[model samples]
Target: MLAGLLSAGVPFPKAIELADPKDLPDKFRDFIVLAFELGAPLVPTLSQLEVQMRHEERTSQEIDQAQAVPQATRTLLIWLPVVSFVLAQIMGLGTFSGILHPVGALAALLAGALLFAGYKISGRMLNSFLAPKPDPTLSLMVLRICLSAGEPLEKIRKRLEGYPDGGASQLVEISKRTGARLSFLIDSELEQLNQKLLSSRIEEARKLSVRLLIPLSLTTLPAFLLLTLPPIIIGFTQ
Candidate 1:
């Protein structure tokens, strides 16, 4: 509807001013208000946002590909006990009967708990690393474009409030207090900022890959022994 209004030659600010605020996202409203206030072209700014989102998507895909092997390895490790149990039964080792002794059952119970905790912690850590953070530079670009176009401070604040944790809101607030141009923070350093953010994320993913190994090993190694050793020990004793 907003697009249709813009296509009808209605001013960007006026189009938003006439529409219900409840219908629009706070950040989106900032774009329209900024364009209307400055008579700036919203298309190019929106296009930039699209490009940045695409870059983020590509980065996430790369991380997933890089992490796939470790994830598959964990899955197999989790199923190792079941495979061992089935194999032992086929061999008539009857190791499970031995494992049912009071002391043996207690040991098995303890091992199962440890395995559960390890996998849960590793999965949580992996997800935390995989989760995308809001693009810090994306917000800065929005704040700069709006402020440079002389968008209203109240309007900017209202829109930026949607993502309070982002750099855009904080930068705009700082600029307002300092009476500095928002563009001053981004105009020259924008590319550098983008590069820095990308590199930092890649580095973080790399470190997380290493951290994941510790938990996976802790879980899988003990599980390997618990499942494979008991039956062998029983067969030999008999």
Candidate 2:
């Protein structure tokens, strides 16, 4: 039924509407419910998806910056303690022969402590580096696209009604308060909104969101592969 509605050029939300819940598959019912909750209006959703694509592109670029610093710092932290321990053992060989060098051991301990401190500092900086920036560009783009796609401000507001999850919801409220169309709001007042909500860190925030995709992708792939693959690869070979 959904396929039929889609074939007829109906929007996903509308298609779901046409297909009664009782007639639809359980999996499809879940999809429709999610779509409704996400405030789908076909064209608006397409526009939001486009914005997400752009965000992904920007995020890839930022990932390069994060990888160069944080990743290297984490590597250093992991290897430093092991290297220090090995070096101490190597130098202590003379101590077993009654030739202990207190100065050398102290130097090794100091070096290890310095390395550990550097690792901790770098880890903190990296955490800050990946934190999200409050960029209204995505929200603005979504609003513009929804308006351009022939959705009235009122209808858009209605769709976003009572949604308080920030971003989309906040914009919807702004539109209601200002009594301005989305295009005008974005073109004329988005900068002011940025100033008010993001202060001076807007660009940094945007960069961080972009950078996060790299680590997120790196982490997600392994987990996804683990979940998808069978538990046993080779069953007790003879």
lDDT of 1 by residue, 93-134 (tens): 776775766555665676687678777987898787768576
TM-score of 2: 0.41
Cα error, residue 39 of model 1, in Å, equals 5.1
Least accurate 10 contiguous residues by lDDT in model 1: 45-54
Looking at model 2, the pairs that clash are 59-210, 133-205
Give candidate 2's error at residue 209 in angstroms.
18
lDDT of 1 at 169: 60
- Stretches off by above 4 angstroms in model 2 are 1-40, 73-100, 138-181, 184-238
Off by over 4 Å in 1: 1-39, 88-92, 131-134, 152-190, 235-238
List CA RMSD, all candidates.
6.4, 14.8
lDDT of 2 by residue, 1-238 (tens): 4555665788867865776556643433443444455455544444443344444445556655545654654564446444544443365423222212344344444544554554555456567765765444544544555565566666666654433323665555776788866455565554454345433444554554455445444433333322222111111110
lDDT score of model 1? Answer: 0.64
| Candidate number of the best TM-score | 1
